[model samples]
Target: MRTRDTRSVARAMPWFLLVAVVLFALNLRGPIVAIAPVIGQIRDDLGLSAATAGLLTSLPVLCFALATPLAAALIARAGPERAVLISLAGILVGTLIRAQGGFAVAVIGTLVIGIAITVGNVVVPVVVRRDFPASRVGIVTGVYTATLNVGAMLTSLCTAPLAEWLGWRAAITAWAVLLVAAIIIWGQAAGWRRSVLGERVTAPDSSEAPPAHSASYRSLTAWLLMLAFGGQAFSYYGITTWLPTILHEVQGLDDKSAGASSSVFQVLAVVGALGVPVLANRWRPGSVVGLVGTLWLAMPLGLLLAPELWPLWSVVGGAAQGGGITIVFIIIVRMSTSNDQARGMSAFVQGGGYLLASTGPSIVGAVHEASGGWTAPLIVVTASVLVLLIFGITASARVESRHP
Candidate 1:
């Protein structure tokens, strides 16, 4: 029999697992993002008002929060691998249903996809924690995170023209290709694992879990970590939504150029996401939190003080946002002693975080409307960074204590 360390090493970099994770990630965000590019088309064709049409996009985000407990429960029963297959299937079915036409069908399909994504969001981190050794968790999780962004970027960039050519229904459903690929590959990997490892594949044992995180919602650590995660989500959504307008209005850039500048934030987030693992390997978790926190702070402050340097702020903030999410997951998985604990902790953190996230755009927009400038909104974002730092460092300190 292999010793624990050898077992850890053998499972650390399995090619099939890596590919499956990549595929899973590639499909995860594309479906949701597909709507953003062709939203007006859907609106005009369906004869719906702006808010109703927005439901196709915004409802999924709400589902991410409201349906999280159910997602956690599914993971608790189905096991991670099977839960993944279920998620992909849900996404595929939902996509097809969405493409069937009619506003009611589209809304239902979007809700299904959102709920399915909530399952993936909760489980994949648990999967990474289970399959990878401690040394590689950060990197693998970063890859997963980065691939999600890639999925959104690819579809966001492509879907508009596809909608023009094929019509919104076909174009929106076109991303089903990703879901198909992910499902098949992950399915094969599942069977292959059963053959080689003879794994029983059942729910994680939570009997030994410490009380602090056993009922994760009641855990102080979980609440603080939730706040940290919320800060990351709030700041990310707010900036991603408004950055282009900020650049255009403040920098006097044209729509295309301002949009291009905003892409700097989205694009560099991959770098930031991938970079977190490298930093995690070298630095203390607390130190990593501090670095990302500073970067997060710099974006909002720099934009406020030196609006002309929007490009610079966008780049740094993009990386910070990527790292922000990656590090938060690292802490969540690191703090868990079992898959059950991981599921519970992740549900609390992510559910609460996304709930706050769903409000970000509206709140920021309201603040901008009330104040009649970006300064107040930026100030609000800066406050969110402080929340991230204080709570992230606090949670990361607990991670060190748990693992050290």
Candidate 2:
């Protein structure tokens, strides 16, 4: 009878874990995204240039790349559970600091927020892998990824209206509410079930371990994939930062309306995130990249050719950006011959990609300022998409794995 009761408890734990993860996901992207819709207001009040305004978005991404080693160390020292609580605390402090509303204060607060998020980014996968069985890992990871998009969508859709109601400073800082909720729930889950959530690490299957002769790092294809991922990251972050501004400037929509429309780009990512894997199961991995890459290209092209069709462009770009990131990781794993190489390639791609991503907003904003029109910025986006296709498509073809 005790054995049966224990088995039932074990069965129930994964759902609890998943729920904790979902709440945690809601905080990660939403806090950063909360800035995008209200960026125009921020620029005006702060007396900031477009490039400086762009830094509001890029600064966090830059931290994601530069502070990763620090994040990994924090995770290692604190453990994923404690590290998560620490991350939430940091985000709360940062949000409050950001609310004080000065240029230096904003930058410092954003930097702190970014560093905290990097900790969560590195540790959450460890939490999922440790808590769930192999069969359940994929599903948990998928939910984590999808929920990220949901968080971004909610913030993009709501932040402008929230700003109108409460003013931008209070509005951006309002996201701290999510951090507090995540802390309470995750704190309880970890405190009560520490043993289950921090179960002994599963021993790796020998076949999945890296061989002594790992060579993926030396591959030119690996370098190309890294650059391709850079392009994808560049395109996604650039557009995400500026799309609402562009709409307001070009089509004369109010901030609230422009932000609401931009939400279409973010929300549609749910479809693309889940759809890419399913499509990959039916088509060649490279073929999937090609199709999605074309969709990415169409976004900027559509915007440039017919700004009247901005809605269509947003939808296409939304799904494409989501799938674009997914497929690059898929190809990274596919191109690897062993777990070690795959891990190395992933770190390499992500580290380089984010460094490039950190420049996207500033570069695009500067171009827009220079040209005094959306045409230059759209062309810049179009060129980045072409980079993804050229290198991403080439690297995607090198997939040796039977499944994506």
Candidate 3:
């Protein structure tokens, strides 16, 4: 009877763990994406300039780049589960701070929020690699990535309506409640006492020890991965930050329609995130990168040539950018031989990638200001997609990581 009960508990653990991870991913993007749809209101209310407003969106990506290196150390000291709780606390605090409604206060809060999300960004891949079977990595990654898109989509779609109903301050603050729930669920499922005690949580295969030095940092393959990841971030953030404004100003959509259109991008992104990995399993993943790159390039060109077909362009762009990120992440995980290596590679990819990507929104905004239209900015996006294609091809070529 005792043995049977123990087996039962063990069998149930993975499902619980999966749910927790999905919920955690859901919380990751909502706070940030919530701002994009209502950014016009924020600028008007706070009396911000275009550059400053661009900075508001770009600041968090900067934090992600700067703070990611520290994540592995935090995980080493506190363990992954505990580190996640700390991240949630930071998110909670940052959300409250941002809700205060001043420009400086919001920037500070966004920085904090970026740092917190960076921790999860580094650690979650480690957790997935550690906990799941090698064959299932793609599927599991898809699940979490899809959940992330779902969160982004919901926040983008709802923020305008929520602000109308309850005001923007309340709309932003409402997401903090998700952090609280995540904390509770993570603590309950992971066991707070065990995590707090600094008990080492080993993978099922205990012989795979942490690497002494991450050789991936020295390898050309890893650099290619970083470039690929950075390109995706550049496209995704650049487009996400500006898409609503473009639709409203350039495409002649109303504010609500523009916001809804932005949500359409994310909704299609969910499809791309979930479906791309499965496709990769069947095809040579490297070949798919070219196709994805073409899709990304077409977005800017489509917007430039045919603003009337924004809906079609948005879906194609969303699918490409969304699937591109997921593919890069899967590549990072596959390149690692163990969880520790995965953590290190994840840090490098996101740290450098985000650092590189942090410039996108600001540069696009600056170009838009200089050129006095969206054409120049869209051309810049097209150029970035070309760079993405170049690096992505090399990154996806299945070269063995030196560290692995």
Q: Please provide the root mean square deviation of candidate 1 (C-alpha atoms, Å).
A: 2.9
Model 2 over residues 1-404: C-alpha lDDT tens digits?
A: 96686667667878877899999988888888888778889999999997787777778888877876677667656667788899888888988998796899999999999998877765665566556675554446556767889998788778889999999998988888888889998887786465443343233435556654344457767778878988998998889878988889888889878876667888877777778867766678678888889999989899888877889999988889888877776565455554345445555576677888888887998999999999999999999998999998777765544343
TM-score, cand. 1 vs. native? 0.94
* Cand. 1 Cα-lDDT: 0.87
Model 2 regions lying over 4 Å from their true place: 37-54, 76-79, 125-139, 160-169, 188-194, 197-222, 244-260, 281-284, 329-346, 368-376, 397-404
lDDT on C-alpha atoms for all candidate structures: 0.87, 0.78, 0.81
- Local accuracy of candidate 1 as per-residue lDDT tens digits, 1-404: 55675466446437679899999998888898888888888888889998788788778888888999999999877888899999999999999999797999998899999999999999998888777788889999999999888888898899989988999899998888888989999998887666555544443354545555579877888998999999999999888888888888888899989888766888888998999999998998899999999999999999999999888898899999999999999888888888778888999999999999888878898999999999999999999888899999998887788788
Candidate 1 collision pairs: none
Any runs in candidate 3 off by more than 4 Å, and if so which?
37-50, 192-213, 247-250, 398-404
Give the better candidate number (1 or 3) by TM-score.
Answer: 1
Of 1 and 2, which scores higher on lDDT?
1
Cα error, candidate 2, residue 375 (Å): 4.3
The TM-score leader among the candidates is 1
Could you tell me the lDDT of residue 210 within candidate 3?
A: 54
